[model samples]
Target: MRSSVDIETIFATMAVGLVAVASILMTSAPLGAQDGSRSRPVSLGADDRAAALESVQFALAELGDGASYVWHRGHGKLSGVVQPTQSFVDGKGRVCRHVVVLLSAGEKSRKTEAIACRLENGVWRFDS
Candidate 1:
């Protein structure tokens, strides 16, 4: 079994990684940019967004790097995949993970990359 220290270390690493992802999301241009033209951000209905967030939270909480979780709802109108690409410790010592979320509805799809970190209450949330 892993010791408490080991677990803490792992969480710290994840936090750092998540912080980096948040930074990137804040500063970088939107994803899917091509030819210097910005693309419209993917839009999801409230319910679909919530559903996708659940999958993202689950993936960041339970899956390791490169692992993916698929989520679908709304009679298949809403579907997507969540994957964590990396993990690290944030400056505030929170555990974080860099995640990729793809949300699709019918023929339209939006891809988002963000960082997720555990709050003090032990719940995971996307950092900004």
Candidate 2:
């Protein structure tokens, strides 16, 4: 049989434990908001949007970094016309959706295609 004092002490310990957990969680909440660098979007879930947008972003990242012609623009948020012939394969085995981007500069409308080199390390380079 426990005395009233024992029950009260138990409840107090439980309450203190709960407060400690809550404090830790509150402190970590901001960390979750930030990436390791504390800059830019974190969350792998955030990195991946819906299928269409994700594919577009992956493609643009390839174009900007891999393609010598077109620097990585992170332009997936914008709209662009992609020719059907566009295709990309990373170095390792990942295949990226290729895009035939049309660069219009004044009188010159130059067309160039970009592909993702399937690098095993997930580093995108210029592919066919």
Provide the RMSD of all predictions against the true structure, rounded to 1 decimal: 11.0, 21.4
Backbone steric clashes in candidate 1, count? 16
| TM-score per candidate | 0.62, 0.28
lDDT per model, in order?
0.58, 0.33
Off by over 4 Å in 2: 1-91, 118-123
Residue 105's lDDT in candidate 1 = 50
> lDDT tens digits, residues 1-128, model 2?
11112222322343222112112212222223423554332222222223323333454454443343322225332222323244445465576545454322122232334453344666433332
Model 1 segments more than 4 A misplaced = 1-46
Top candidate (TM-score): 1
